[model samples]
Target: MHGGGAVLELAELAFRELALFAAFGFLLGALDNLAIDLLWLRRMIRRLAGRRDAAPWAIADLPAPDRPGRHAVFIPAWDEAAVIRAMLENTVWRFAGQDYRLFVGCYPNDPATRAEIEAVARRAANVRMVVCPDPGPTTKADCLNTLWRALEREEADSGTRFKSVILHDAEDVVHPEEIALFDRLIERHDLVQIPVVPLPHPRSRWVAGHYCDEFAEAHGKDLVIRDSLHAGVPSAGVGCALARDALGALAAERGGLPFDADSLTEDYELGLSLAERGRSGTFVRCRGGDSQGLIAVQAHFPATLAEAVRQKTRWVAGIALYGWERLGWHGGVADFWMRVRDRSTILAALVLLAAYLAMLIGFVLLIAALATDYTLPPMTPVLALLLGINFGLLLWRLAVRAMFTGFVYGRREAMRAVPRAIVSNIIAMIAARRAMTHYVFARRDRPPAWDKTRHIFPETAVPRP
Candidate 1:
């Protein structure tokens, strides 16, 4: 009898623990959602009422060119053969009249990528290839380091000077006007962040919608809010331009350390590093009518659900491991505010875990009451009202985005992605947690080789329009 009683007590304790944890998680999630809503409100107000010129950081305007600005398009590739040629073609066509040089970085082992780049470079006069030494660590940062060394050597060999180095992934098609935008922005700020949008893929799977959601929130609301308050914007990895002086300063400061070689998402880390060193960032408009902000980049979102999860998981892990840790030390008021933006997935995961446990417990209790013929108190009207308001905020925010971005998605397509986003976020949180834990727990280490995301582009995929 005592043993049975003890067992019951243990079970009760476990349930209580879970219930408390779950409740806390739900509250956290609710708060995160509220934060996003507040950000969206700030963005909308700024767009409607703010002066376009008054905000120096809003958009870049190019000066009339007597002498063209000296710049280089630094494209770093690792096994990107699937979309390299398309990117090159788009880049050349867009920046044809500009005074920019091309530096295509490739790994020795990636023969397919090298061959494609080589073929494209032959037709393009200004494009030059920098082949990095083989047995590379499959990270963009590593490629950047190799490219930077070559760039420094080239700069030494020739007396030529470059004003800025623009970074892009091999798969992205940069907007033609980005050069003009950067020219204006560079006159004021040392670093500029361009917006990223997924290439239009209507028939693409659930990943397309997920990408759209991210681009809308990150570029439209999150960045707009940051710009309104003069806060630092997180790097989109690609589509950003860095002044040559800033690059030199960063390299000098770190000695031989590759800026982004530590984790999967090197672009984000590089952006954060600049801010950590007291560099201010200007948000160049990448979208909207007659606005230079919507510089189109023909890039693919992960086509399969697994690819989406894998890609997001990598971001989650890398941001936690590299971004949070570096910012943890030198973070100021700006950093604190930005943490609310950067920790979206972490906040979402905690909330989902909490809400699920809470409802599960509530349902189980209600079922037991029914089976035992016992009268149970119904959930109070006040509690019901609170829950409804909580969900209302979420739907309103999502609906606002849907209305503007016009759902290229149907009911079946949209419905399928809803649960996938939730699951994908959970996986992302797990990846983030694992990366943070590893970084904290491990002692001395070599560079971590990340699991590569396999491309799932359609067999009939053509260049993005």
Candidate 2:
């Protein structure tokens, strides 16, 4: 009986401490999120006012050039033979008339991918396969650099310059109007990014559907606000175009290769580094009209928990750890604030874990009190106020998430976002923990290798609204 009393007392103390910590951290995050929401609302109002008179620009897709400017598309592949052929063929069919060329980087060792790309190159006049000098499994950035070198040679031989360069993954199902959209916007911005919609995986609703929800909210609401504020927009690493001049600027400053080979998230850094160099980036979310609902890239993300965690671990490690080490806080006010938001995910995950543990302990304590006759200690006034505010913020956050999700994916998926949020939280927490253990404290001498998850292109077309 005495030991039970002692254990009860200890559990209560732990619960109180955990609750306090979670409440404080979550309160800060809630306030930050609320600020972004309010800012988005202001931007929406201004956009409505601007369109108060003229026809909506979204009714029709952006005008395409009769002879679109010469553009280069770079896709780096390593052990991606399964999906490369389909992706390249689809791209060839969709971009049939665009004045663009495909430059696929393959490894000499990964003959499967090389053979697949080689097959496509043989049939398509504009398709060029770039074999990397290095062996297999080098960083994606290195492969991109190899492709860039090949493009430079082609430019020298053909006496033609690409207007811009687009980055894409092997699994992406690209929009036909993507190049035209970028060409239209590249006149004003150094880097132009489009939305990325993860194809819904009906088989893995919890693991894969969470990405659909998260990206819908992110690209739908968060990035829109960032672009409106003129803040530095992080690249989604796909569906993004960098002005040839911008790439040249970075390459000139970088002594040769524009991309950092050492970084895990070279594409994320590419846009931010350009921003640091006084270049501008924009995130455009526009309708493509007709069967093409949104002018964005669609791809299949990880459909299993293990795969999802593996993919996100690299993201957490790259952004939260390596990003901080390389690109510290050094931009304008909005840029700095956005960077802070990017780095806050890991800490937020920790707080969430603590909150979950606290809730479990509280439930157990409640059972104990109901079974016996002992009353628990009263809550602190500060904690009570914090809890009340947090509860309200939680509901608001969910509603906003659903709204943004439904805005893109329709009503049913928006409803799924509620339960899927729990799955997202769990994956984030595990990935954050793994990131801290692997990248944060690992040996510095080990070279960065390819951390890419296996590719699985959607076998069928993803139905668009």
Candidate 3:
């Protein structure tokens, strides 16, 4: 009986310690969320107080160019035969009248993707395929570098310089007015990013729909705040345009290779690099001519748990781990704060794991105390206050997430956001584990490989406007 009682006492002690740790973690997370929440509230108050009559810029307000300047769209493909043709066809058909050229990069080993690109190029005069000198499965940045070289050669041969170079992916549904938008905005902004909205999946609401939730909040609120704060706006990898001068400067900085061939998230690094050099980057969100809100890019995200986890693992590895090593801690106060936010995923994942473990232990202790008539110690005032604040902050975060998700998606998806957040948390934990493993290997001098995810393109025609 004494041994059993001793074990019970130890169990309670462990539970108390775990709760304390969780409370500390929750405090940190709540503090971070509070900052963003306060910023958003301030913006809302300012908007309500002052600009009630003025409207944001609409796509229709921009004057049609007398002659469209040459613009290059770079798509780096490797084993993307499944969606490359559809993407190319949609892009060509949508921008039929615009003086834009589609430059596709393919490897010698990936003949299937090259064939798909060639098939689309055969029908579209403006589409061209640039074959890479290397074999298949190289980094996307390497493929982009190959395309950049091809763009230089094309400019030399045709004696027409492209005003801006746009980046996109194989499965993206390009907006009809996106080229025109880039053409107009590149004049003022050295780098222009458009919001990316992930299309809802009919079958995989939890896996794919989580992406919709994230992007909706990110593109809708976070990026807006980032721009307002004058902290850099990072590229979404697709639907972003880089001015010719900006691209040239980047290439000159690295001796002809504009994109970082070694970085997993080169697109993200590119945006920060431009900002570091004092180049202006803007995120444009506007209504299209058809009276519908138009985001620059829309595509299907990973529709399965495995695929989603794999993709997120790559992202975490690139942004949180490798980015810290390469970029270091450089920038202004806002920039440093954003970087901290970006790198906090690993800590967040650990906190989540701790919270779950604590909940399980606490539940067991609650049952034990009821049966044995032994009560756990009362909560301290400080811990109780922290827990209360954490709960409130969590609800606020959920409400913000739901607001953004509902604005883009309907009310139904927004309702699912709360439950779907759990799925995202689980994914984050898994991805964090995988990312740490990859980072460990990388630190030991192992080169990072392209962990590409298979993409899907919707069969039906994409909604335009």
Candidate 4:
């Protein structure tokens, strides 16, 4: 090839790389704009209005006329024996005084978990344990599926009726008053999402900070936007309530399909499917600190950076491969927009990977040109502005998170955690890329079995008499 042609080809490649980097930057920037303009503003305004202590919109007062109906607290357990007992204990203790029933979903192979759950049931008449017959690779979704089957058979025999179904994680320790909130919301909304706030350890590790950041951004700002726009708010895999009628209809429409079956991130997919199936799912911002909040659920934020990354990686991979195609976003503008947002989130790490490569190449080329006495491309003000704008936006996000998070880890501690979070990002990026690649290349496009996350339960603070 001619020297001139080779140089032209090289220049074309560089331009393409730059364009790809810019495109990713633009997508992230647009997402930032949406969060700030649509969601964060409401959160900030709510703060300014001093409405933090105000009562939740879901329930004005407890013991409303519609509080009493057959409601099932569906807790899907898979190898959760470590925390399952505590979770069930709290569920029973809290609901002991309520007018509803407690149903725990467990796998038969997990004898310890089954036994503990059974003991909890024996202690409380309102509690019952159902075995999930699936011997296939264990997933929370499968457990829920088995529970749904059991419920169906029970309803068939006795003609029992239920008004609502609430999902809770085994690690969760819900507030006593949460039942009332759920009862109130069930009376009005088809689906309702309650805030899942992280209960951070005082001496939390790096992963805890990352979890806190997610909760602050998602629960604090993200839900605010969903409320403002009247769009759907996805559940945090827990504290989600579904009206029994709508749930029954969804199940019937799907030929009595499991509530969340064969999906990695079933909760998220469930929420999206509900929205697509013409159901309204909304959020309620409850009042107070984590301890004083209306619904204080004890959930362990990944104790280590590696665990956090694994969780996010599975989420990104699951959502990208299974959710987007199945959600059917092409049907309408709203669906399309939701898909767009979900895609942008899933692609964030990929975009960053591309941008980093481009920047590296540009840097190496600039250095070689300087050393070789060759003319280099001039830096433009627009490029500088673009870089500054991107950095500023990220900094703004961190700042917003810090402001609302209230007395977070010290600056030194945060800096230590940042690298751990970065490591997590790298792992998640690799996993997401692999999942996406498999989705496009594999002959069978079926989703792999869900790998349950290992929970490191926080040591309970001993109560002083």
Candidate 5:
């Protein structure tokens, strides 16, 4: 009985310590989020004070050029046979008359993907496949570099210089008006990123739907604030356009290879590098003909838990671990702060895991104490205060998530965001663990490799409205 009492006491102490740690971590995260929220709030206040029309710009306001400058669309494929055909077909169908060419990059080993791209290229006059010299499974950046070289050759042969370059994945559902939007925006901004909305999965709500929730919040609020603050807008890899001049400058700086082949998140680094060079980028949220929000790129994310884990692990590795090693902590205060927020995923995941464990253990202990007729000590005032603050912060976080999700998706999906956050937290914990392990092993001798996730393009096309 004495030993049992002692064990209970130790467990209680452990619970208290865990709670303290989690509360502290949560406070730090809340502070960072609050900073962003405050900045966004300030912008809203200023806009309101100026009484400026907050209406979204209509797509018709930006007319397509009569003589559109040539734009090159880069699609990098590896084992993407399942969706590449659909993607290319959609691209051709959407931008039939636009002065743009779809340049697809494929590997020699991925014959199925190559075949599909070839079939599409043969069908469409504007579509061309650029086969990489090297075999399969190289980084996406390498494939992009190969496509860049092919673009140069095409320019040399055809005497048509592409004014802008757009990057996209094989599974993306290309927006019909994106080319026109890019055509107009690239003239002003060096890099332009449109909102990327993940289409809701019909079956896998928990796993795939989480992506919708995240992106809705990220592109809707986070990126908007980042752009408003004059901090760089990181490229979302798809639905992003770079001016030809910017690409040329980057290539000249990097031995004629604009994309960093060694980096896992080259798209992200590219935007930052351009910003460092005093180039401008913007995140445009425009309206379509129906006065509804449109001009956003849409795609399906991973539908399974395993696939989500695989994709997020690569993101954590690239953005959090490898990014810190490569980019370091540089730039102005806002830039440095955003970088810290970006890299906080690893620590955030650990804290979440700890919080969940602490809750479970505490619940079990409470039940055990009641059964044994033993009472645990009362919570300290300071600990209670911390818990109250954390509870409020959690509620605020959930409300913000729901607001963003509802705004992009619908009210039904917004309600789901509250519970779906648990799914996201679990995936983050698992991905962080895998990412750290991979990064440690990669530091020895191996370089960062492309961790490809299988993509599924939806059968029924639901165009972005």
Candidate 6:
């Protein structure tokens, strides 16, 4: 009886400490969300008053380009034989008649992916495949660097230069007008990013469905809000366009390599680097085509929990770990705060684990108290107030998330977003731990390998714009 009581007392003590940490972390996150919420509200109010912005428009008109400027689409493929053929064909059909060339980067060893790109290139006039000298998947950035060199060589040989460089993955569903949109906007903005809508798998709605929720809110509101604050717009690794000259400047700065070859999230780093260098970058989310669908780069995300965790682990390692070591905190106030927010994922996962443990311990303690008839102390007023505010903020965040998710994916997925939020939290926690284990203290004997997820192209025929 005495030992049981001691165990219960220790559990109670642990529960208190864990709850305090979780509550404090939640409050801090809530405060951060509140700031962004207030900023978004302010933006909407001004827009309601008929305010006009030069760069980031809420609804911009995009018409077909009249003999559009030269544009190059860069796709870095590694073991993407499954979907590369379909994606390439779709890109050719969608962007037909547009003055753009598709430059695909392939590895010498990955003949499967190279064959797919070659099969498409042989049919399309504008499609070109650049083979990397390296054997296998060195890094996505290394492939991109090879493609950049190829583009420069082609320009030198042909005496023609591309005006903008658009980045896309092999699994992307390219919008017909996105390249033209980039061509038009690249004159003013160094980088322009369109919405990235992750296609939810029919089978894994609860797992892949959460991505739709996240991208909906992020691309729909958070990025727009960032532009309103004149903050740095980090690239989503797809559906982003960079000006040719801006990229050239970066290449020159980095000894002819525009991308950081060692970085996991090279596209993301490029956007932030351009922003830090005072280059203009904007995000646009608007309707395109007669169907009135959003001009987003839709792609299939991971459907299984293991795949999701692996992909997110790469992201966690890239952004919160390598990103910090590479790009130290130096930017405007808004940009600085945004960087902190991005890096907070590590701490956020820690808090989530603490909160879950606290809940478990609390349950155990509650049952012990019930069995023993032992008295418990009253809740502290400070802790009570903190939790109360966090609850309100939680409800607000869920409502807002649902609103954004429904905006893009409709009511059914929006309702599912509530449960998927739990899944997302678990994935984040797992990814954080995995990132620390696999990437942070990784062995440095050999080069970092490209760890890309298997991609899927939509089997259904894509509708023409």
TM-score for each model:
0.82, 0.95, 0.94, 0.82, 0.94, 0.95
Worst 10 residues of 2 by lDDT: 53-62
Q: Across residues 1-465, which tens digit of lDDT does each residue of candidate 2 receive?
A: 213488888998899999999999999999999999998887777677885522234625344444457899999999999999889988898888888999999898999998889898999999999999989899999999998898889999999988899999999999988887888878778999999999888798779999999999888888888887788888888999998888987888888888889888998888899888889899998776566777899999999899999999989889988999999998779999999998988999999999999999999888888888757778889989999999999999999998888987889999999988999999999999999988757778776899888778876753332
The collision pairs in model 1 are: 285-293, 286-293, 286-294, 287-293, 287-294
Q: Would you list the rank order by lDDT, best first? A: 2, 5, 6, 3, 4, 1
Q: List lDDT for all candidates, in order.
A: 0.65, 0.87, 0.85, 0.66, 0.87, 0.86
Q: After superposition, which runs of candidate 6 have C-alpha atoms over 4 Å from their true positions?
A: 1-4, 54-67, 444-446, 462-465
Give the Å shift of residue 102 in candidate 1: 2.3
Candidate 6 vs. true structure, TM-score? 0.95
- Model 3, 116: alpha-carbon shift in Å? 1.4
Instruction: Check candidate 6 and list the clashing pairs.
Output: none
Question: What is the TM-score (0 to 1) of candidate 3?
Answer: 0.94
User: What shift in Å separates residue 256 of candidate 3 from its native position after superposition?
Assistant: 0.4
For model 3, which pairs clash? none
For candidate 2, the TM-score is: 0.95
Estimate the overall C-alpha local distance difference test score of candidate 6: 0.86
Per-residue error for 278 in candidate 2, Å, reads 0.5
lDDT of 4 by residue, 1-465 (tens): 112345634854774567457655754655655555555565556756868643343345333745567677788777777887767776676665776667788776788888878877877787778887765356777777777776677668869777788888877877676667777777777787877767665565555666765665567666656555556566667888888888888888877864656566788887777776778887777643345544535577676656666676677756766677666464365455556666665567666676666767676666656666445555556666666766666566555555545434346544544454455456556767766765677554454565667765554621122
In the range 305-398, model 5's lDDT, one tens digit per residue, is: 9999999998998899988888887778878878988899999998998798889879978888778777767887888998999899989999
